[model samples]
Target: MFRFEKYNIADWFSFYRILAVPLLLAFVWYGERTLFTWFLLVSYSTDAIDGFLARKLKIVSARGSQLDSVGDQITLIMGLIGLIVFEIAFMKANYGLILLAFIPYILQMIIAFVIYGKTTAFHTYLAKTSALLQGVFILWLLFFGPVYWLFYTMIIIGILETIEEISLIYMYPHWVKDVKGIFWALKDDRRTIRKKTVKKNGV
Candidate 1:
């Protein structure tokens, strides 16, 4: 059983997204596109809220980061399902480009899992920008129609973020969290520690 007592307020906000998945799915099942999209917006909103509260309240933890990533993945998947179901024509039209953009992300995920035994929670600035744009694009596409500019922009940022994630994976052999980006990682003490250890071990 989860120790609810130990979970802080920000953690509860993170929990809100996971707990709301079923309702979003139910809306999807019933062909309620608007309802699903609206609920998804709320879910995405909680992502920002949780992160802020975690920072302001100074209750951040490894577990919270893990939960945040899990919630994010679930929300993104649900959003994609919504887009596919509601915008089949758009998806069909851009399936090739979509796959091209998504394949790198899938590959990056595979690399992370193989190396770290879990998905990363680096929360790099690029990752945050990618997520923000993605959420906006999905919501806009669902609410209005496909905006080619936004779609293409999301694709490019997403690919760049994937490349950065892959690079970070190699930079830190062990998983680390809250990395800002490549430049920040280069200056991170963890890299120095690893190098010193490697030198001491002569390996």
Candidate 2:
């Protein structure tokens, strides 16, 4: 997973977020909310940049997809930690609501791990939209405290994205990456191609 020689520019961009985790945590530990927010913004920006580079530069790969997914998960988790630490009162006030939205997400992760032994890298359209909403909400909360409308939007989109992920997990018996959405998943040849290859080899 840490094979540096195999990584491309987009992969490196994804890797940067993982590297930034400690710095983000230190900002929280030192009680530097503004600095943490700015750095977190950078992390969020990289998420967009890496995907653009991956598609534009045509550097997409299974390993790159996995790396990007890991980076996204780490950055988001750190962002949440930063929020809880710096915005304790706000988080506490909305803890139950947050957990209610998060339960399906947790279940989605469990389903992916059970099916693929790791988090998925489907990167569907809904998932991308959900990530955008999450970043917007996080930045808004950090810069302007909690906003109810943004919070509601983020939660709703998140639940939808998690449902889509769960469906994709069940749809693809083997792991896949970069599926656009359910419609695209329905037509994907990855599973059938693998089955054909296996049968061809009598495996």
What's the CA RMSD for each of the models?
Answer: 1.3, 2.1
lDDT of each: 0.92, 0.91
Pick by TM-score: which candidate is best? 1
Query: Would you list the clashing residue pairs of candidate 2?
Result: none
Q: Write candidate 1's Cα lDDT for 20-94 as tens digits.
A: 999999999999998999999999999999999999999999889988988898898899999889999999999
Q: How would you encode candidate 2's per-residue C-alpha lDDT over 1-203 as one tens digit per residue?
A: 65678889999999999999999999999999999999999999999999999999999999899999999999889989988898889889899888988888889889999989999999999999999999999999899878899899888889889988999898787898989999987778986787788789998
Clashes of each: 0, 0
lDDT of 1 at 31: 100
Candidate 2 regions off by >4 Å?
A: 1-3, 194-203
